[model samples]
Target chain A: MKTRKADPKGVMTGAHYLDGDFALAEGALAAGCRFFAGYPITPSTETAERFSERIPFVGGMFIQMEDEIASIAALIGASWSGKKVMTVTSGPGFSLMMENIGLAAMQEVPLVIANVQRGGPSTGLPTLTGQQDMMQARWGSHGDYRIIALSPDSPQECFDLTIQAFNLAELYRVPVFIMTDECVGHMHEKVVIPPADEIDLVERKWYEGPKDAYRPYKPDTDLVPFMIKTGDGYRFHTTGLTHDERGYPVINAEVQDWCVRHLIDKIDKNAEKIIKLEEEQVDGAEVVVLSYGITSRVAIKAVQDARRQGIKVGTIRLLTVWPFPEKRVQELAGKVKAMVMPEINMGQVVKELERSVAGRTKVVSVPHCGGGVHDPDVILKAIKEAVK
Target chain B: MSPEAKNPIENFLRMDRIPHIWCSGCGIGTVVSSFADALEKSRLDLDKVAIVSGIGCTGRVAGYVKLDSFHTTHGRAIPFATGLKLGNPELKVVVFSGDGDIFGIGGNHFIHACRRNMDLVVICVNNFNYAMTGGQVAPTSPEKANLSTAPYGNFEYPFNVPYLAEACGATYVARWTVLHMRQVTTSILEALNHKGLSLIEVITPCVTLYARRNRLGDGLNLLKYYYENSEVRHGADTRTLDIRFQEKITCGKFIDVEKPTFLDCMNTHLTKTLGEKFRPYGV
Candidate 1:
C-alpha cells in the first residue's frame, strides 16, 4: 500500500498505490468497515466486487443480496449493529433502492451508497456514463426531508468522496450518496491510500448513559436521535412512517409537521458547515462556469482554457449537491454577469443555478445525452457566448 | 411459563398495537397468542428476535410484538427478514404472514425465501380466504371452496403449505391448526428456536369470511372441526401429507430434517474461503 505522506499539519502530500477507487475503499476498511452488501451492476460492480473480496479478509461481512432492496436493507441492519456499512449499485439498481433509501432516511440509518450514474430511464445506456441521476440522487426518495449528497468529478474524488460519504453519514446519521458518473467510477488514476495515522476517522454518535436511559430514537436538541446498536442492550423504535421522538409511528398532523421540518432543518441549518465546493479563479471574473461530479472536470478545464485566452471566466464546482450551496452561489452569482452549466443530463443543476441566481446572471446549459461526456469545446463555447 | 397467570405471551406483545386488527373469534389471534407462549417458553431474549410481517390481516405480527419487528410491504416480509438475518448472524428473525398474502400474491417470494434456507422462522396462518379484503378466494382455499372470488366454487387446486415448505429447502416443516392452540404453540416455538428456515403452517379459519359463506357455523363451531378431526403423529411425512390431505386432513410437526441454515454455511464458508485473518479496519 503506497500510503499518503504527510507534513506536520497533516495536509495531504504525494501519491502512491493504484487509482482513486481502491484507495478510497481501502481507507473505508481502515476507518472501521464491518459490512458490505451489494448487487453486481456495471461500472460500480468492480467497487462491490473489490469490497466483497476485501471485507471478509478484514474480519468483516460481505453479502451479494438478491436485489437492491435486500442489499440496502442489509446495509441498514449492519449499520444499526455498530458496523461501518455501505453498498454500491448503478442507476437502475439505485432506482430499486430508493424505497429502502427512503427507509434509511425515515429511520435515520447512517450509511454510504455510491451510485455510478449511467444513461436513461429503463436500461437506457448501461455501459455508458451519464450524470442523469444528478437530480434523482437528491429527490428520488418520496417525501420531503433534507439529505447530504456529494459528487465526485474524478477517480481520486471517487475514492476520497466515498470515505467522505461514510464520514458525513456518521456525522449527521443520514444516508450519504457519492454521485460518481461512469467516467469517474471506471477510471484508473493515481491516488495515494492515506495511512491510518494520517487520515481522520468518524464514528456514529451514541448514548453514553446507562442502557436503560439510552433512547435509540430519542431526539437530541439538534433533532437528531442517538441511535444504539441492536446488541448494545437499548430499546428504540425505527419506523418508516412519520415518527415521534421515541421512533414510534406518529400519524398526528402536528407531530408530522415537527418531525418533517426538523429533518429538513438539521441539514438546512448546518448547510454552511456541511456543504463543500471547489471554486477556481472567480476573483473579478464576468462569466462563471458551474458543474459537478465528472462533468465538473470538463467544466474546470473549459474555464481554465478560457482564462488562458484572456477571457475572465472562472469555475465553481459543487462538491456537495443536495444542500444546494445557495449562499455560495448567490454571493458568486452576483459578481458574475453570466454562467454556463454543462452536465450529462438534459438540464438539472442549471435550474438550481437559475433559482439561486434569480436572473442576475444569464444561465445556459450545454446538455449531453447517454453516449458520452459533454465535450470541453462545447462548454467553452457556452461560456464565451454567455460572456458576450 | 404459565398460560393465564403471569402470561408468557405478555413478553412478546407491544401491549399497544393490541387490541389488534384481528377480528373477534379470529384464528390469527390464537396463532399470535401461541407465538408469544412459544417465545416465552423457549426463553429467548426479546432483543435477539426480529418478527417481520407482510401485508395481510395476519401481517400485524410485527406490530403487536415488542421485539425488533418490521411491518413491511405486502408479500415482501420474507426477503426483508432474510436481509435482516443475513446482515447479523446472531439474531433470530421470523416472517409472520397470512396464507392469502404469502401463497397468493407473494408466492414467488415465499418459494424463493424457503429455497434459500435463510436462517429464519416463518409462521404462516392458513385462513383459506382473504378475510381482510372481504371474502376473496386464496391459493390455499380448498377446491370447490366458496369465497367472493370463487362464489360458484373454486376450480383451482389449493396449496398444501407443508408440502410447499418441504419442497422449498425448509429444514423444519410442520402443520398444526389454531384449534389445537397448545400443539400449535409448541410447533411454533420449535420453529422459532430451530435454525435455518423453519415454517409452521397453522391451518387457521377465517370466521368472518369462509365460515359465513360455507355456513361452517361461527368461529367456535369452525374450531370444533379442528379439535375432533385433527391428527397428531411422529415424523409426519411432509411429502405425503399434502397428497394424503387430498382426502384426509393431516396436521402435526410433519417434516423436521437436519440441514445447515443458510447463515451458518454462508458465514463459515466465506470465512474459510477468505482464509485465516481479515478484519477490514483494524491494525
Candidate 2:
C-alpha cells in the first residue's frame, strides 16, 4: 500500500478539545473526504453542520440532501466521480438509507457513513445513546452482502477511526461505517491531530490498463476492481443488479452466484487483515468481557471492578465489528470459561459473539434497550455470573 | 457473427443487451429513440455525458445508454445526478425514469431537486400507472382510472406534473406525448441546451396494463387519440395541463426562464463570503 501525507489544506494539525462529532468531520477532511451529502438527524447532525461550515474552505462540497436515501445515493455518485464522500445520520434516517446502502454494496462504492446512533426501533429516542442499529448496520440492506463497520469508544477514537473508516472503504471498495452512539458523539475530549505527513491515507486506485479491457466489476488479485472517475473517457456502465465482469446486468443463478459471492468473499477472505480487536488480560483469564462502542468503555470499569473482587476477568474491545473477529473469538472461546457482552441494544453484537463461540463456551448478553448507557454494576454482575 | 448493416443510432446503445424488457408496442422504446436523437443533435461530447435512472421501465435507459450511466435505487436518480454534477462540474448529468419512480416512490427527491434547481435534465415518462410492477395506481393516474391498486376507480386527484415542476422552481419545463415525435425530440434537445434544472414530462402509452385494464384500445389507438385530442399551447398555464381519460391533452413548453442554478448560487455565495479563502468546487 503506497502511503502519502494528508493535504495540508484539509489537516488541522494540532491538539484541541473537541466533541466526537466535530472530530469525525475533521477526520474526514484530513483523510481526503471532499464531498459529503447528508440529511441532518440528531446526534449526527453536528457532523453535517461542521462539514457544511468547513468544506468550502477546503475546496470540497457538502449537500444537505432531501433524505438519507438521497444522501447515500449522492455519495455513491460522488464516489464514482473520484471523490471520497460520506453521510451522517441517526436511526430513522439510517432506516431510510438502507435501500441505497444496498446499492452502494452492489456497486462496491466506497464511502463512509457515520451512524451516530440514538435510541430507536422507530424514533425511540432522538437525543440519547443506543447501539440498537449494530445488527441493522451489518444486515440492514435487503440482500446478501458484506460491509465494514468500526466502533469508536471515545472522542479521540472517533477522530482516529473515521480516518480508518475511509481507508478501509477504499481498500475494500465497500461502505465503511463509523458506528458511534450519542454518548460517544456528544462527549468532548482532547484530540491531537497529527501533522500532514504523519497521517497515512489510501488513495483511490485508478485503472491504468487498456480502456477496452476495462471491466467495472472485474476484480484484481485483491478482489477490488480499480475505479475510473467520470469524464475519464472510459464511459463504463454500472448498475445495482447482478452483473457480469463488464458491469452489465446478467440475471441468472450462475451469474448471481458469481457476483454475490465476490461481494461477500472480498471482505470475508480479507477479514484477518480487516478485523482489529484490542485485548486486555484475555490470555489465561477465566472470563472475558467482549464489548464495543460506548459499552466497551463502560465494560472497562466493570472489568476493573471484577478484578478487585478476585475474578480473573479480561477485556476484548472491538474496533472492527462486522467481519466479527471470528478467528480470535473462536480461539478465545476454547480457552475462556465464558464471555459476557454488553451493548446499548437488546443483544446485537452479543449475537455475533455467540455465533463465533458456537457453543464452545457460554455467551451471556447484557442487553440494554437504549436511551442511556449501561451502569457498570449491570456488566459487573454479568461478568460474575459468566465465570460461575 | 458476420458483419451486418446496423442502424446508425446503434452507437448510442448497448446493442449486446438489446431486446429490452419493454413490452411490444410500448412507447418507452420510442422515447429512447427520441433521446438518442436529441443527444446526436446536441453535438456535446458523448464521453462527458452521463445517464442516471431509478428503478422502473424508464430506469432501464441507463443500462442501455453507452455513456457513464448509473441505474441507481428507485427515486434517487435526481440526487445521484446532483452528486455527479457537483462532483465533476465538467460532466453533463441527465436523469431518466418513469413517473412512478420519479413522482410516486421518489417524489420527495424530485421536489427537492427542483427546489435546489440542481443542474440536471430530468425526463419523466408518465404512463399514468406503475407499468413495471404491474399496472398499479400511481400519483399521476387520472381520477376514476382503473388500476390494480385502485380497482374501484381512483378517487385521488392526479398531479399536474408540469405545474409541480414549475412550482418547485424548474428553470425549464415542458410536456409532450409520445405521438408528438418531433416536438418531444425538440423539447429534449432544448432541455439539454438549457443550463439549470430542466424537466420534460412525456406522456407515453402503457398499452399492455394501463390500456387493457382501463378498456382502452391498443397502443396505436392511444396514439390516434393523442393526435386528435392534443392542443399545442406554447407557454400554457401548467395548472390546466392535467390529463383525463380520452380528454384534450394540453402539451407544450410550460416554463422556460433563466435562473441561477444550485451550483451557481453555491459558488457565488462562497466566493463572496470567503473571498480568496474560498476555494471554488471542482471546475
Candidate 3:
C-alpha cells in the first residue's frame, strides 16, 4: 500500500532491548500519536510514564487525568481535534473506562486503548499475567457494536502491532485495542525500529469540500466517513445519542436501526480484510492448538513436545482476536479431528472457537484462572488427549 | 412579525431545536438567556468556541447552542473540554451543566479540574436536585430539603459550591441567583475572558420539582424570595456562603486572582527542562 517517511522528530530509528510497554510507547510516536491521556495502573503505568517523558520532545501532549474514565474521555476529545491519541490501563481501570468507551463507539471517534491485562473478575492478580479480559475486550461496553482487538506475543510484536492498531483504528474510525498481558508488558526483548521512511502510517481523511455540505456521519464507499476537525471553521454538532448523517440526534426506531447496524456491519462485513492470524503446519494435521497472547508462545513448546511424541499437532496463533477469523476456523474444523485451546482465563476465547466449529469437530479447552501462564506440560497433556 | 423576527437571540441558537424541554417558570431558561447575552457581547470568534455538557436538564444546552458543541456522557464534560482546549489552545471551551451533574456524579472531575486550573469556563446551574430524573436528592440539595429520594426531607449536609471551588483552586468563583440576570451575565462575560478554570454557580428555581416540593409558589415566588432574602455581598468569604434551608443566600464574586493554567505550567516546565529541544504543544 501507500508508504511515506515518518516525522523525524518522533522516529527513534534503531535497535534496543526494551520491554513491551516501552516499545508500545515508541510505536505510538512512530504512528504519529500526538496526544496521550492516561491514568497510571500497574504494568500499564510504564507506557504512560514513557509517553509523559517522550511526547513533550516530539511536540505532543501527555496528560495524566483524574481517572481512567477521564483518561479515555480526554483521548476522545483530542482525537476530534485532529490528533492521534491513546490511553493505557489495566483491568480495574479498564472496567472504569467502559461508559466513555461506549461514547467513543457511538461517536465513531478513532483512538487506541492498550490494556496490559492482569488477573481479574475483580482485580484477581495485579502483578501477575492473565488473559481473563479477552471476552471483556470484545464486549466490554454496553450495546451492540464491534471493535478490532490485537494480541502481541513479544516486545518486538508489541512495537509492530501497536502501529498496526493505530492504522486499523484510523481505517475504520473505531477504537482499537491492544490486548497484552503482564508477562509481555514487562518482559524485555530486542526490538528493532526501522528508519522513519520504512514504517507505513495512516493519516485520518479530513473533509475538504465546502464546510456547509459536510455530513459528519455520512459514510464513504468503505463505510468509514471523513472527519471534520474541530475549530476548522466547520462548527457542527455531535452527541452520544443515536444521530442522523448530519450528526444531530434523531430519537426513533429507524434512526436507531440505521445507527446500530452501521456500527456493527462496518466491521462484520469487512471481517476478512480486518482479521489477522498466523497458522503453522495445519494443512493435514489431525489436531490443532489454537491460542493467543502469551499462551501462544507457551503453546509452541507444547506443540513441539507433542510432535516428538508422534502426535501430529499443529498451531494457530491469533494476531487479531475479535472479528475472530471464524470462516477460517470453520474451514479448518472440517479437516482436523479436534482443536485444543489453552488460555489464562476459564475458557473465554475458546467459546468463540466452539461457536465457529459448531460440532463439526471436537473442541477442547485447557482453562487457567490467571496468576501465571500455563505450564507447557499441562498444555501438552491436553493436546495429547484431544487427539485421542 | 414571525417568531424568529420576535426573538433577537434566535440567530445564536438552533431555532429548529426550539420548544425546549424545560418546564414552565423553570429558571434554566433565564440562565440560558444570560449566557447567550454574554456570548453575544463577548464578540469572540464563535467558530473557535466549543460548548460541552454532561447529561441532565442543563446538559441539553450543548444541543441548543450553535457552536461546535459536544453532548458527552454523564460527569465527563470537564475532562472532555480540557482535551479540546489543550488539543488546540486557541479554542475557548465552556462547560455548562446542572449542579447534580457538576458536583454530584461529576464531583471528582470538578475538584480535579479546579486543582489543575485547566483553562475552561464552567457554569454550574444549581437547581438543588437531579430534576431531569424526577427530582432526586443531590450533593447540592439543601439540608432538610424535600426531594423524591429524600421524601422525609434530606438530612445530609449540602456542598458550599463557592467554598469548594475556592478550596480546589479556581481562578474565578462567583454565585448569582437567576433573578440577578444582568449581574450573572456580567459574571459569565468576565469568566469567558479569564484564563484559567472559572466556575459560576447559578441558583435557579426548578419549578416542577424543587419549588413545588418545597412549598415555594412558582418560579416567580422563588424569584421574589431571592430578591428579598438573598443578600448581595460582593467578595464575600466562601466559607460562610453555605445556603441553609431558607436562610439569607450569600452571593457574589468570592475568588478572583491570577495564576498560570495547566497548559502554562506544562509549557513553562518543559521549556526550562528541555530547552531548545522542547516544542510547545498545540503549535
Per-residue accuracy of model 2 over A105-188 as CA lDDT, tens digit each: 999999999999999888889999999999999999998999999999988899999999999998889999999999999999
* Model 1 per-residue lDDT tens digits across residues A1-388: 0123222222233575444455446545655666777888876787776666666555666767777776786677667667778887789999988877877887788888888888987898888889888788889988987778888877767767776787788878899888877777777777765655666656577777876565555667766677676644453546576777756666899988978887788788878988888887789889888888778877777887788888998778889998898988788777888888888889987888889989877889889986698778888888888888
- By DockQ, the candidates rank as 2, 3, 1
RMSD for each model, in Å, please? 4.5, 1.6, 1.5
DockQ of predicted model 3: 0.80
Query: Per-residue lDDT tens digits of candidate 3, residues A1-388?
Result: 2345678778899999999999899999999998999998997999999988898778888999999999998988888888889998999999999999899989999999999999887867889999988888889899999989999999999999999999988888899999999999999999999998888888776778998898889988888878887888777888998999988889999999999999998899888999888999999899999999999999999999999999998889999999898999899898999999999999989999999999999999999998999999999999888888
Per model, state how many residue pairs clash: 6, 0, 0
Model 3 residue runs over 4 Å out of place are A1-4, B1-6
TM-score of chain A of 1: 0.93
The better candidate by lDDT, 1 or 3, is: 3
| Candidate models: Cα lDDT each | 0.75, 0.91, 0.90
The fnat score for candidate 1 comes to: 0.24
DockQ of 2: 0.81
Model 2 lDDT per residue over B70-99, tens place: 999888898888888888988899999999
TM-score of each: 0.89, 0.98, 0.98
